[model samples]
Target: MMSTAHMASDSILAAATASMSIHSTSPNTTNSTESSISTPERPSGIDNCLIETASGRPVVPRRIVNPIAVAPMVDVTTSHFLHLCKIISPNYTLYTEMIHCNALVYHPDDLYNFFGEPWEGKVVQLGGSDPEAMAKAAKLVQDNGYKEVNVNVGCPSPRVQKGAFGAVLMKTPSSVVDIIQEMVKVGVIIPITVKCRIGVDNLDSYEYLYDFIKLVSTTTPVTHFVVHARKCWLKGLSPKQNRSVPPLKYEVVHLLAKDFPHLTITINGGFNTNEQIKEQLELVDGIMIGREVMDNPMFLAKVDAGYYNIPAEKIKSTEEVIEEFLEYVLTEHERGTPNSNAVVMAPLKMLYGGRRGKEYRRRLARAISPRTKSLPDIVRDVRLMMQEMDYGGVTTASEAEDNGGSESDSDSDLDAASHSASGCV
Candidate 1:
């Protein structure tokens, strides 16, 4: 006999396939492009139309242009990393790491540490079960200029479970609704979304997943969801194990998208290539890539030109991208902001992944050692080392001008150094 979960899934899949077939045959739908997936008819007030603030200023619209987003990883998707990803792929949405509601409400002073330089198109992910707490956090997120606030209900870490949040909340759909309703009531103008697993522990059935999404969508204003496409064991499996041990059932997510065409559905988990992304885009509205992008940050360099059709001239070369990021770091360092070795080294690691990667990594690691004493010294040494190795055929900012590179390039380096000196005060 088929297991109950499999049976429910098969039934849902059949219905979803039938619905898709009907839609595919419609003349209006068949003529539309793959990028323009059809959403169900929403009430007029819910079409993501523009809304004005009380003071008469037009609020920034909450539009997701390309529909490709970076998944919110626990420790990896920091503000600096989000900015780096944006520098590589200008069109894709970026998400911050999962932040606790209490931290935002109680520790306002430390907020800057979590949020680096402000950039448009970044989403903030909040983890908490308290509706009031989430409401307060959403306002703080809005005030800080994040265009979207996502509720994290997909993390299966024991620490998150102990706090009565994360994947555990998947079992309690009503509470999730309360949290989202509170955020909407508190006047968050941007889109509020949820990130969740297909199921959690014993709730590993298609009906359970469907009911959860249905109830939340009907009861609240949230119309977007990023599904992880796997169930969480919630016990006996470590957080790392939870990520890999669960068998991925991407079809379930695709079926959900077909069944609820009105919702903006994005699938996350196990996607590594543009081909996989293209395949998923046919069934859903968006794709969210996680560890693969973090481990190989340059993977995003192809996203703008390849996926979004951004013109080649608009895309920066690897050398130009690194130089621009270093300029940002130098500015942060100059503002008496504590320098983060992780921030300084992230782009370097991404850049050194080419021909002489190992040697470049070894030398740059030595140059940025604790004894380097200052950000300027570290930048100077790394530039000299890269020039010596002809890494990526990149010349030092000064040497570039001397060798007939753009004058603007040399001026940028001088400006960065001057700011770095003033920051040492």
Candidate 2:
């Protein structure tokens, strides 16, 4: 019945505009003229509720009323997927897949093709080891209209390791400190956060993690962190194997919350069900979930009512979400968004999940594999597929694949587009 987020995102942008006057009716808002952007109440323990660095440059984390986030995934967490998730549940934070700082610094033009136009509620995650390069990329991201930025220290893929970032940097906490220090030093106004594993290789001790957080937070202004509660193996395991072989140590992250009461901590990895998420929310400031969301995005339909405690009436139903995403697909298709693989298939193939929706997904793959028809026609075909599903005896997609493991965003099933202004040619 309205724009996603009830158009609160659009109004927040006006604050960044020349007009000093803007009245925001977003959740938890009282009258204010300091800045038009309204921030959700941060988790209780932190002071002033602002995301700041050590030297005291503060940027109010805007619009996210709840700490729930769709964890960044390669090929999985596309801009279009984020758009669809927002239509279903507006309050949760969304993330882009890790873009190399070098890419952002150098290839700014191609990014929109790879990742649609930057939107509200979506945080950009940058991967790099150089402080100056990361700072430049952070500035570019802030300039492009994103509200926040996250540095990726949790990805354990070989390609990332080869780039000297990701889980490899856990071995070099000083390097992470350097990167953040340089980012905040430059004119990056948005809140810069870090996403990292608890430890890497043999540096898996709690004390090592304690020292890492202590050094980084004490030296830099970075106060918020997303910790994947698992020690990653830098060698001897493929990224997929690394995700499974490492045992999840949730208590380590819990103790981290207890120890660093001043900082905001969000726990990621090994979260699947709502009960589990609710239990962890009581322990940490937030939760970021991956694979499960990509597999069954319908889970987002309940986020407003379930996590943020909004009325059930405001939430979208499964059919409504399907319809909304289809209309969006048609719009983006006509707009000529080049990478349909990301804009279309990333969410479409798995929009419907579990045993009941397998047939719908199968039909989607078939309809999309051949790009002969217009996307509008394809959307109509999929709508018909949903209408004619015989879920009576469907053998489901693997239930065993849904286990809570470290997210491996290494598989980019999406391809960057050939040059075009919209990147959707």
Candidate 3:
């Protein structure tokens, strides 16, 4: 009773599973008699290097070579937001929201929920303690064109703590190693990275963190670690409180880089401006920014030109980026994705942060308020408002009247349109 699409999907999964089974044992232990497995065909334009493993199988090389990455955030770094960030800074690495392994296993159809083009430079962060579950989730990410999979052992949210994953796993170094080993075993050819806090609760010692890193590195092939540069007080603090309340011990992360020079160590937490990022780069391999980027996304407009050495002519302006994103919004609207309003509006809300942005921000908020009707209507209102605000160019009141409205009349039309939209009632 399986549909054709379901059958095809099952075949792909079966092939992947068989491939893993053939290469399941330690590459270091394979004998001459074992047949070498071929590397998967990579996408065009990706610079891939194939190397023979100890098992003699051809393996594709994967590493976090980018020097800057946007941290994965819950509910905040959705596909829409990532698309916007990509527009502004094409070279900086991006991460998907922390996806629970259980959900991925149970709801396979949800994979198509990603709402953007150009999947390159993105890492999918998965949260789970179960080694098998994490392995399956890692495979799903790889199959979906993500070049890297990150194990999120840094989230201190109470919900994650209850799930026995996230920062809580830092206490069980052995379990963390097992998770990474299984992910590698299940054919995760790309870099399997870990994001962790400096320490958790009572285990806040440099030796403790070093031990955790050593065990995982020695036992598995995980070579990249993004240290959040803070300890998580699992019992007393909320997740938000955990972010700020813990004193940032950046020196601990710097020491990590010095001690584990072979590993790619990236520092996270308390980084906002280019100056801070430049300072951290002197010690660590990379930097990850979260809340600051979300609050003032315009900051990313400088990343390509400043950090990546991309030419100024290649970088698009804020207005040009917004215009391009609105086109994407229309496409998603036509597709009729659920909660499209919230998804499309999330990044749009972050658009007006420059000069004369206060009034523009207020108008944008009202345009996408719950009172707004359909996605199309919201788009129309947003476009009109942007034109009136002289986002890309100035539109005088005389021009507004020529287009069938005065300045105040346009505002009145927006209010009336919000009520007329289908969902507002």
TM-score for predicted model 3 compared with the true structure: 0.75
lDDT of each: 0.66, 0.65, 0.67
**Which parts of model 1 have CA positions greater than 4 angstroms off?**
1-63, 309-313, 393-425
Q: Please report how far candidate 1 places residue 177 from its true position, in Å.
A: 1.2
CA RMSD, predictions in order:
13.1, 15.4, 15.5
lDDT of 3 by residue, 1-425 (tens): 11432344344334333432132222212232332222222223322243534422233332356778888887767788888888766768898778899888887656657524437788888899999999998888787777888898888887888899999898777678778778877888987899998877766656566667766776778889988977776776667666666667877787677666667888898786668887777677789987766665666765555555566666676667777888878888877665547556667555544335556656876777665578778888888888888755322111211111112212433223221211000
Q: What residue pairs are clashing in model 3?
A: none
| Cα lDDT of model 2 by residue, 206-289, tens digit | 555666676667766788899987666666666765555666777778777766767888988868677888887767788888
Candidate 2 stretches with Cα past 4 Å from truth are 1-64, 303-305, 308-313, 341-343, 390-425
Q: Mark the 10 consecutive residues where model 1 has the least summed lDDT.
A: 416-425
- Each candidate: how many clashes? 0, 6, 0
* Model 1 lDDT tens row, 1-425: 11433444445445443442122221122222221122322222222333534422234333347678887876567666777777666777888788999999997656567766556668888999999999999888887776788999888887888999999898777778778878877888888999998877756666567767876777777899999976676676677666666667887887677566667888998887778877777677888988666555666656555566666666666567666777766776786655456444544553444335555555756666664357777777777876787646332221211121111222222212211110000
Name the TM-score of candidate 2. Answer: 0.75
